[model samples]
Target: MRSSGVRSASALPCKVPYRIDIADPPDDALDLLIELGALDIEQLAGGLAAILPDSVQPEAVALALRSASITVSPAQGRDNDSVWLLRTAPLRAGGILVVPPGVDAPEGSLRLADSEAFGTGHHPTTALCLEVLAEIIAEDHPSSVLDVGTGSGILALAALLLGVDKATGIDIEPAALEAAAANARLNHLGRRLRLILGGPEAVEGAWPLVVANVLTAPLIEMAPMLVRRLGHRGRLILSGISTTLEAEVRQAYRHVGVNCTASQTRDGWIVLLGQASW
Candidate 1:
């Protein structure tokens, strides 16, 4: 799942950018920094360096690095914009078209901009979700959809393009909501998509299809609520779960009487598809 922690980093006042230079950074070190809201990152002579927002105290970052057992030091004056180089290209996931910003979307493609918000269809979680979503549409053709934690509204918008009559997307981060709205307009699905600014609590009624591509912990916590939003015979697609957590996540939904109907895995990430017991 995309962390919302970095959503507001751009709003924080600019202060001295702290650089954390690592010699032989661990494979997961970059993931950890991204999770902790690093503003920018670059490769350096010995290894990699990340520029953290001023709001993130250096001590906190150092502690995180130590916890990961990654060797790092604060390099006081180095700055780089290479982080922005990380961009999403047009992705063909299932029958969906995921086009990055500034790139023209071909016919029937879903246009999304590169922003701090997540879900550019680059992440495996998103790709897995889109695949299952397309399968569901082809099999059941659910009339409506609700996308929880809809980062860039990619899932919801894709559902619309794939023939779902309408879709609703909810996110706790204002930046994500803003990005989703822009993406809806980009795809010309603004009228068919509704962007909400809160979690499931902000949504009303039920949907024939629902998708939540959030992490395992939050997925477990919201299991009941998400299940409740499903209409009779409705389907739920849950992703952003690691393979190790698959059973645990499935049990969470099972506890709420939702049976896992299908599953797909890619790059160690798993997506579980469920349907409420009739």
Candidate 2:
């Protein structure tokens, strides 16, 4: 997340640029650009397109974003507001609709606030995780869930809305936990959603189901701990892994006695479902 009010510390040009391009931006990308006075913004395929004031150079804004690991490329263009004018439509994760906070949403749709944390439902992994989560919940009716690396708490929140009794969201980043907490409240799931500002070790309890949508490496490293925290007949959903690395991640869990019973792939990303092989 951008500091509340940080004076420009990086080298940036003085003239404001008209257009900005961001590739693989974080969840807070849109919020940050909007905060940076972007005239308008649109989601791109694994990127972002933002219209900024042409009066200033793109250097400052670009530098500011790079500090947060988001690259902002200068893409000057003639006024084309019409290009992104019709994107207010909501996105879907399973049967749940994803809309920005305060936007008109059908009942039960997620009204996610703009956040710097991840899991804004823009990524394919997040949507895939939700699709699998919905299916698992529908089939098993698990009462509670543990969401590891719960960025915006979208997964845990969705679990509650999908009929799970309670959810605990864990994230190593404090900012992520904060974002998740706020989102839980936004959807009135705060009371049912517990936010933990640390890794899985911060909490101790076996869960009927656990969902972790973090990247491949962390998932591999945390395989044992996560599997150990599952109750009898527990189910695990692991995502954020690329198709190329699917075998490596699956092997890591299988090494700890997990039998991945199902898997799905989308846009080259993969999600896996596993159970303890007793």
TM-score top scorer: 2
Cα lDDT computed for each candidate against the true fold: 0.79, 0.78
Candidate 1 — worst ten consecutive residues by lDDT sum? 1-10
TM-score of each: 0.70, 0.72
The whole-model C-alpha lDDT of candidate 2 against the native structure comes to: 0.78
lDDT of 1: 0.79
Which stretches of model 1 miss by more than 4 angstroms? Answer: 1-85
Candidate 2 residues lying further than 4 Å off, grouped into runs, are 1-89
Q: How many backbone clashes does candidate 2 have?
A: 7
* Candidate 1: Cα lDDT at 142: 90
Model 1: per-residue Cα lDDT at residue 177 = 87
Error of 1 at 98 (Å): 1.3
**Cα deviation of 48, candidate 2, in Å:** 14
